[model samples]
Target chain A: MIKKMKIWQLPLMVICLVGFQLYSDVVLAHGERAQQAGIRMRTMYWWDVDVQPTTVKVGDIVTITGKFMPSSFWPEHLASSEVASFMNIGVPGPAFLRMHSYVNGTPMVRSTRFFRGKEYHFKVILKARQTGVPCASCCQC
Target chain B: MGYTDSVKDSDNQSHEDTSRSDVSQDSAISTPEQQRRIFRAFDWMLVPVASILLGGIVVFLVALTVGDWDYWQDWRDRRWWPLVTPVSLMVAPAVFTYFFWKYFRLPIAATSIMMGYMIAAWVSRYANFHLFADFPMAFVSPSNFIGMAIILDSVILLTRSFYLQGFIGAFLFGVVIYPLNWPAAAAFHTPLVWDGYIVTAADLMGFMYIRTAMPEYVRIIEESTLRTFGEAVTPLTAFFAGFLTILNYYLWVWIGSKLAVSRWATKLI
Candidate 1:
């Protein structure tokens, strides 16, 4: 005979599994997405994310434009202005595929910072890094 | 709870009546002691699993904080950016907690809770520095934090009182915070005069070339030292840092001992 799980145990296990997966997803998102759980240090301008052709296919030329606004009390732990402004575009993962980033129009292969209220916009080719997901950070948001 | 109950109510009146009565009687009976014992047993049994899960979470948090998000998709990323620190620092101390609690009749619930902070800090670093913004520290270098955690755990392992552990661990925590982080942190702050321009390694790597804002012409280094170790200042700093680490170690051992002795600990099988 199959050992039956108690009525409470079944729900508890499901909760644990979902909790574990959510924890994994946050850890995978890295920076702003990861840290917001504790100290919500940065306030983002999601309303300002301008995406040309919000829908795109693999290998489509899409432009993603957005601005990140840090709070007035940006931590001094952040040493440099260049190190404070950062931008990243990627799908949720198994694999975090970063498509493009820029620091005041300069190509940012590494993470960089922007001024507290400054805006950043970028245009790039979205070569569907992976299949089955629609290409838009906002759509997912 | 089952479809059979519905069928029995419709087709088997006698069986349905008996089953309903059994359910009502079982619900009415008091079994709090049995439930408590069962939960206590489960909690003790799950300790190792919980410890492993805590360790894994720490690894995941470290990777997010330390590893470059741009390189997460890149195949050539290092195998152990985040995991190494947690495995050594966290797991060792957790295992120490488990052993202390089980073998030496100590309770380490507090130490386990502190691991949550370590995980949170790791995740926050990843979110704030490594992922969201650009700070020029390589491989997230959270390994520096392992000593702090080890010290915290060691205090719990060595002490018999929470008051003493809390007082000493907190002090040692503050004392060793700068030292443990100094080496890697120093790399980011090290002043380098590159091509007549005063810059850090972060500035050397294609960071901003802000010549106009700071006016590079005005800044000048009158004295220069290229020796592997900078004058006596380097040695003095190292000696002080090492001294702090040893002091933290002593404090953590005490904390670990205190945690291991709580009356709330479940019996080990």
Candidate 2:
């Protein structure tokens, strides 16, 4: 018997599948790739986020320096700063050993109070581990 | 009859005949045995392909989008942790239901869905770690997903009712994840010292594990001091999580049913 579906429909399905894979977004990183411009304008703006040696060898010590200024009109939906806030950075895991982190040129170990409209410069020194080193770091506050 | 009327009548008949022939040429009704063989072949081809496709897309999107890795302590510390955390994760179970209700049906649907979902999650997480970022497998692991699947499936199997499964099964499904993961969570709850912050083991693990490049706002969760429930005394979060799961179960089941009634099923004949 003649198979009409196999003749035309099957080829279309295959082409569609192949096309989907080919055009699929190739994300070089994880998390939302782009942040809404309004969100950035309304919320915290960190203009200078500088990390030296974009690429580092295993066990090589690296430093992260950035200026963070929180948005004055903070959205009510977000977490309230009434609770304990910390000066933290986002990292992959223990893979990149954090030797130390300093905020406002002071040695900091724990969660600290973050002030809105304050341009506080923070620095973190991390050693790249053999297996993995979090190439990214973000504030948990 | 007049000459013009007879000619028009013949033209109309010929047109109807041509249309009927076209329909017959497109597809033919098969014998019962042939239909059975066709269905079996379709099953063999569609099952693996569909599961892999759906599972891969859903799991990867969840992981890439809302996945909280390198910091379970901070994650669990949130107030709406239970309600919001499972929002995206619910996609897998929701879609997996289609295969269960449509083909596998009752009694066996739970087990089939569980295995299929597990394989799908395993493949996606493994690929994410190796191909995209060199994060640890434990970060995006789906081991906990197994319990939820069984609970969702068993609700129907044990109760033999859809509404009951929605209310009870989904509740059990959400509540089960915490206890099942308690042993893992317990390890993190252990008191420890890290950078003199007086943190837990889980916090230390976060300080230790390295995610290549993650953002700050992404780690946002409701971390209220009131959320701390006297060392799991009330299981408030778990219950809340279960409540949310019930909502998710209904939503997912509805979606599954809609997908089950596809245009393809009409073509089977």
- Which lDDT tens digits does candidate 2 get at residues B131-188? 4665565544554566776777777777767788878877877676666766656655
Model 2 Cα shift for residue A77 (angstroms): 12
Residue B67 miss distance in model 1 (angstroms)? 11
Q: What are the Cα lDDT values of the candidates?
A: 0.44, 0.59
List the candidate 2 regions with Cα displacement exceeding 4 Å: A1-57, A60-96, A104-111, A116-123, A130-141, B1-46, B64-66, B69-81, B85-99, B102-104, B108-111, B130-132, B209-230, B262-269
Docking class for model 1 is incorrect
How many residue-pair clashes does candidate 1 contain? 30
Task: Compose the digit string of candidate 1's lDDT tens values, residues A1-141.
Answer: 224557768889999999988776322122434345334544444446676776555555556666555555555443334443333454432122234445456655333455666655653323332345444644765
TM-score for predicted model 1 compared with the true structure? 0.33
What's the TM for model 2?
0.60
lDDT top scorer: 2
Give the alpha carbon lDDT tens digit for every residue of B1-269 in model 1: 22335444434543457775565456632244444565567768776566556655655554554333222211111122222222223333443544454464555543554465456556666776565543333633243454666565567668854455445643454345445555654555556654344545533332221111111111111111112223344444444444444444445555555566644375442
Chain A (alone) TM-scores for all candidate structures: 0.48, 0.60
